[model samples]
Target: MSTEQIPEGVRLAPAMVAGARIYIPEPTWCDVDHASENASCVQDVDHRTAPAYLNRPGSDIESLLHVEGFAELSGAHADPVVMLNDATAMHPAQALRWAKDVVAFAEKVETIARSVMPELEA
Candidate 1:
């Protein structure tokens, strides 16, 4: 994708990290799209606050654009009406297909990252 092709209401910036930290995830709400048979959600819903580990260089790196599907919910604000546990019902065949999708997505993220941060590539 070209710079001009980025989503309209999106912004990107660079920042320097100082130390290790953890972040709490914000709740995400989505409605089921009947036409596509998928959830209508936002991006970065599955991304970790800290994308890399500074303490251990080259540690098991994750895709910057990580994607995850919701399975269960807990806590005071948990909604029994919305949360689904269908992920538990995934068959071995489905798991394999999902794994292949994740691999493809990671490759796309790597390509985009390289295009934007060519200097950071080793």
Candidate 2:
């Protein structure tokens, strides 16, 4: 048997539901109806708002990620377009806070990465 290794910095969001960690990327907001039913709520994370990580043009980390969110919802899931590359998680909301949070978290990661590998900016 084979199993996929969860990426580094990846973690199960504390606010996850539906017996699954996946959140639907549609709707652009958390579904109170679904949450009231104790179902999964889609948390959209837009990392594009963070310009620090993008400072290093052509960087793999920069191109590999974007402003997006992920939720398993069920056994069937979709690959996250932008992996925060950190262990932080956030709840779904209609405000830009989620997107800002993703960017902030990503920036923190970049800061740590630069501290260890200064060449990351080159």
Candidate 3:
């Protein structure tokens, strides 16, 4: 890939894709341990962010969120998406809007928590 085609903060690195040697862009936030002998780094010609999680209070439930960007060569699915755990995928714009809603809900939760425990700090 040409320097002009690379995204900011990404570096091209050699990898085996579909039994052929190719260079893949690795972003700064990528958590794939490419050095591992058994690493499964490639994901359908896409790069992904490290997973972020939010755990429920007093419960084992945890929610995961991550972003995935498909390589330009990925054909029809070249657009980036925000993945919610393993369940949903949203475009960046949609994810931004959904994030606003999540912030509002979190604020409401904080309010309720404070009402129940006045000394609680968010």
**lDDT of the candidates, in the order given:** 0.37, 0.41, 0.63
User: Please, what is the TM-score per model?
Assistant: 0.30, 0.26, 0.64
Q: Decide which is better by lDDT, 1 or 2.
A: 2
Worst 10 residues of 3 by lDDT: 64-73
Residue pairs with clashing backbones, model 3: none
Output the TM-score of candidate 1.
0.30
Q: Give the per-residue Cα lDDT of candidate 1 at 8.
A: 51
Measured by TM-score, the strongest candidate is 3
Top-scoring candidate (lDDT): 3
Clashing pairs in 2: 9-86, 22-71, 22-72, 23-71, 23-72, 46-67, 47-67
Candidate 1 on 13-115: residue-level lDDT in tens?
2222232222222323332222222223322122112211223335555332333233222433232221112224343356568668867987997889899
Model 2 regions lying over 4 Å from their true place: 1-95
Compose the digit string of candidate 2's lDDT tens values, residues 56-103.
565665453333344443332233333343333334353257577767
Please list the residue runs of candidate 1 whose C-alpha ends up more than 4 Å from where it truly belongs after superposition.
Answer: 1-88
TM-score of 2: 0.26
lDDT of 2: 0.41
